[model samples]
Target: MTISSPSSPQEYIKHHLHSLQFGEGFWAFNLDSLFFSILLGVIFLSIFHRVAHKATTGVPGKLQCAVEMIIEFVDKTVKDMFSGQNKLIAPLALTIFVWVFLMNLMDLLPIDFLPYISQQLGLPYLRVVPTADVSITMSMAIGVFLLIIIYTFKYKGVKGFIKDYTLHPFNHWAFAPINLLLETVSLLSKPISLGLRLFGNMYAGELIFILIAALIPWWSQWVLSLPWAIFHILIITLQAFIFMVLTIVYLSMASETEDH
Candidate 1:
């Protein structure tokens, strides 16, 4: 099989953005997104688990120290923001923050690194960052949305949940229908905004990386790429933090009583 180089700037961006997909229409799957997302999840989880399980009371290894700092940071954030006590929120927030950061970190690698390697191994194409895919982001946000709904029902009861949509904001019986419409839109918008914000940021970052690689002179590529990569480090971390914080905030809201 021949290794075909991208023919032009347009073709390059187009190819880079294309997922290794299968099937058709609504039934289609982004194989590349799923593959990389799962792989990164496993990798990050395994390392953290190993470091934690083998953790000692004495001096910690560098890897253990780093992992502990991340865990502490996430734990502290959960404690500060989440009001109600549920054993699940801290770990969930930790997983989300680390998993998202790892996915975004893929954008920092040389634009052609993974794709070139995959092509050499006879794979058609690959996009390593999963958060760049809107579907992947939506799926994650929907998972969080489901959790919020679960907590709302658990804490507030079915009646309370219904009442939340129907009352309180407008606080008048005549405005129940109007309040429901407004609150329903507000509730649904959480996941939609969560997903789109991450997707848009990541997709734009990946596109810029691809643009830098495709449009610049090969001899001087790193000049712009290096700075962009550096700035993107902040972006990757901030995006992950924002996602986790918003998830916490949403769940916190769900667990709150209307009387409070």
Candidate 2:
């Protein structure tokens, strides 16, 4: 019987980055991303539900206090950016912040641990961070894009949305073409920015972790990897917060009646 050598660092990283698929060609589904993101969502929702079920008026528990702090922070942000309309906006913003933060936090796990375990269980691939996948990020951005369109029509009406796209900032018939072109470009830029910002940050962070894990001399790997991972806690949190805030801001802009 012949035994195979352990995979090289590059091979290991590449294998881990691959996704579990459900089909071939254009119909393939990224099962790994869907599974992990849904699992994380369930966990987050469970925790929030537990905290809500045990609410207190006199004294707050640690979990309640933490939840309240996050709620207040999200509420304040929405209030400042979104005005007092849109009853659903604040809760949605809060959920996005917490959920994305938790998803990004998955990067903190040991790079090879999940893949190794999955391999043992005969699973071919698993990419844990959904945000690190371009498809996932683009899907999220598209959802935001749809929400923006929906809110635009809801708050401003179909005519208002069209007017804003074709006539805002320049209300003359002669400049209609220019106004329409510029506004269309600006509107399209929102989803592109949303998708790229998240994909870039999470992808870069994952790449760095892979590179660091590839280093030899086990002692040196520990010495450097630990500090980098520690600092990455802040990076992941900030990226998630930025994504959430921008989603709220874009939605707010869509809901606004003014063009400026």
Candidate 3:
């Protein structure tokens, strides 16, 4: 509805941090994050589809050229990192990179722009940066984790996958239990670390933006914010690239039969 302007800096930061949430713990959903994420994803697909449909061999449009560049970059990255023969890896990596980059790109928007519009439309809260949300990042990580399991089974066979957990690091009957424990922790840590790393960086970036907005004088805000915003572009792009590369590497490791 009609959210009043915050009276103090703390109130302002708190208001900005709040999500448009529904339901209770576990069942609760961050509607803003979900909405923006899906919207950006659709936008990514639509732009690519339009470019591909209109693509010409001679004198390509700027949009087509940009799209082709991204596709080639992602294809090359996957080719370099993924040793497996699966056809899905390249497309998956491309989607992860572009989709996550789009989400992170939202953080560059003026912090109050969307929220102010949303307030006028009667939405109570809106957090536009989906990658800053732990649940969103973790959900993507879980998807990658599931793919790792599937690839391990497909390329290594069930027996090899079992041996990966049982007869690994020490490679002895006496060390099987210890190996299982160590491998299990390592396996679980993949998703956790993957998700948390993204969330931590983006959340911190979002917080700094909020602080700049809340604490700085309106007339002087741009003096500091402009430089930070420029630097953030690099951070967002690097985070997306790292996520995609790590996904490719993890799947490659899973596909290999030999232990590193």
Candidate 4:
């Protein structure tokens, strides 16, 4: 996690973008992203666990009320979008929303705050927003992709799943190969596009924050950064909601039967 002081703005941007890494190539790991992602996940689970444990029927505390509202909102969204009767959808949506929102929320922090703290503690490369890292977002997207596969197979069966790609959209043996090609690309693009979308948006947002900090004098940064930060709150929340809604929609489509 050690980094040399940057001599130029390009070097500064490059340094800030670099991850605390280990290993090489495909085996390399971004330890900072992993650390903060897991940390935020644990925080989300711990708070929800505590709130649920003490939840009361009447006069709920502010924390409990907020948690309930979030749960209800996610539940309603699941009911609206997810037609299948899988109990996992609601919880999965809630987890994705909260976990991703928490990760994106890190971008609102002063770009250098955590990294500076880490540097003082003898670690220099620390990127706090896990969503800004493609690997993290892709991992999550792949998880959803796997769930889509599982649900498709669970509801449609192996033969049906194969036929899904190989048969219709043309419904003839002549078009099976063509159908498979189009369907496979379409299915595969779900995870690829999902992962890249979040990564692109958050990465851009993080870079802008870094740019403001690097280019502006500390005394005047508030003039521009404040407005951007306020607007960014909407971006972060919208990204989280989009991710959650898409996950639900994909799973719903996967869980559909021929009867539907």
- C-alpha RMSD (angstroms) for model 3: 1.1
Clashes of 2: 0
lDDT (C-alpha) at residue 84 in model 2: 43
Q: What is the lDDT of candidate 4?
A: 0.92
Q: Tens-digit lDDT track for model 1 on 75-118?
A: 99999999989999999999999999999998888879888899
Model 1 residue runs over 4 Å out of place are 1-4
Report residue 119 deviation for candidate 1 (angstroms).
1.1
lDDT of each: 0.92, 0.84, 0.93, 0.92
lDDT of 2: 0.84
Best by lDDT, which number?
3
Which segments of candidate 2 are over 4 A away from where they belong? Answer: 1-6
What ranking emerges by TM-score with the best candidate at the front? Answer: 3, 4, 1, 2
Model 2 residue 195 lDDT?
Answer: 86
The per-candidate count of clashes, in order, stands at 0, 0, 0, 0
| Native-referenced Cα lDDT, model 1 | 0.92
How many pairs in model 4 have backbone atoms within 3 A of each other, for residues 3 or more apart or on separate chains, i.e. clashes? 0
Candidate 3: segments with Cα more than 4 A from true spot: none
